[model samples]
Target: MFKKIAVPVLLAVSGVAAAAEGTTTTGVDLTPLTNSIDFSTVLVAIMAVAASLVTLYAGVAGVRWVLRTVKSA
Candidate 1:
């Protein structure tokens, strides 16, 4: 069923791509722009992940401590 629609679309796209002019990449330099970009979001995400792990560890420890105390009593 999908082949009926996909074949013609694929052939059309290929034909257009084949007929495209000046599809060459020459002298493209984005070094200066990329170098100045701040990557603080990735650091913040890592800190958030650390916070979640700490919270999970604390919850598990508290539950285990309460269970131990109850069992001892």
Candidate 2:
């Protein structure tokens, strides 16, 4: 009898408490100075990744062009 009456009230209170105290961590806090990396190395890596992406895009475009031509012929 008491449990039936208290359960809903307790659930409602817990929900409100969780809403009030939402401890969400903002942004990624990776490594936190555990590993040291050179700025130039980072830049070079970024450049390499960008070049790879462009090369991939060109390859895909070339394949699409070849497929379209073959289909048309």
Candidate 3:
């Protein structure tokens, strides 16, 4: 049942794609827009620093808890 429905749908989609193959305009220049400043590196660095600080804080808290537990016992 699904095969019957899917075969016709696939053929229709291929026909439409073939019809649209040569309709695109190729006259636009996009080099300057694509060469703008890269901010992904800076964003990744900021995220790494933030994650390091959080890990450091968690480690310090865990050590302090262990020390307090030992002192009380």
Q: What is the C-alpha lDDT of each candidate?
A: 0.93, 0.90, 0.95
Give lDDT: candidate 2, residue 23.
68
Alpha carbon deviation, residue 40, candidate 3 (Å): 0.5
- Residues 1-73, model 2: lDDT tens digits: 9999899999999999999798666856767564565588889999999999999999999999999999999
Error of 2 at 46 (Å): 0.1
lDDT of 3 by residue, 1-73 (tens): 9999999999999999998896777867888887897889999999999999999999999999999999999
Off by over 4 Å in 2: 1-37
Candidate 1 at residue 31, lDDT? 96
The TM-score of predicted model 3 comes to 0.52
Best of the two (2, 3) by TM-score: 3
Give lDDT: candidate 3, residue 46. Answer: 100
* Candidate that beats the other on lDDT, 1 or 3, i.e. the better one: 3
Give the alpha carbon lDDT tens digit for every residue of 19-55 in model 1.
7764666777899999998889989999999999999
The alpha-carbon deviation from the true structure for residue 12 of candidate 1, after best TM-score superposition, in angstroms, is: 50
> TM-score for all predictions?
0.52, 0.49, 0.52
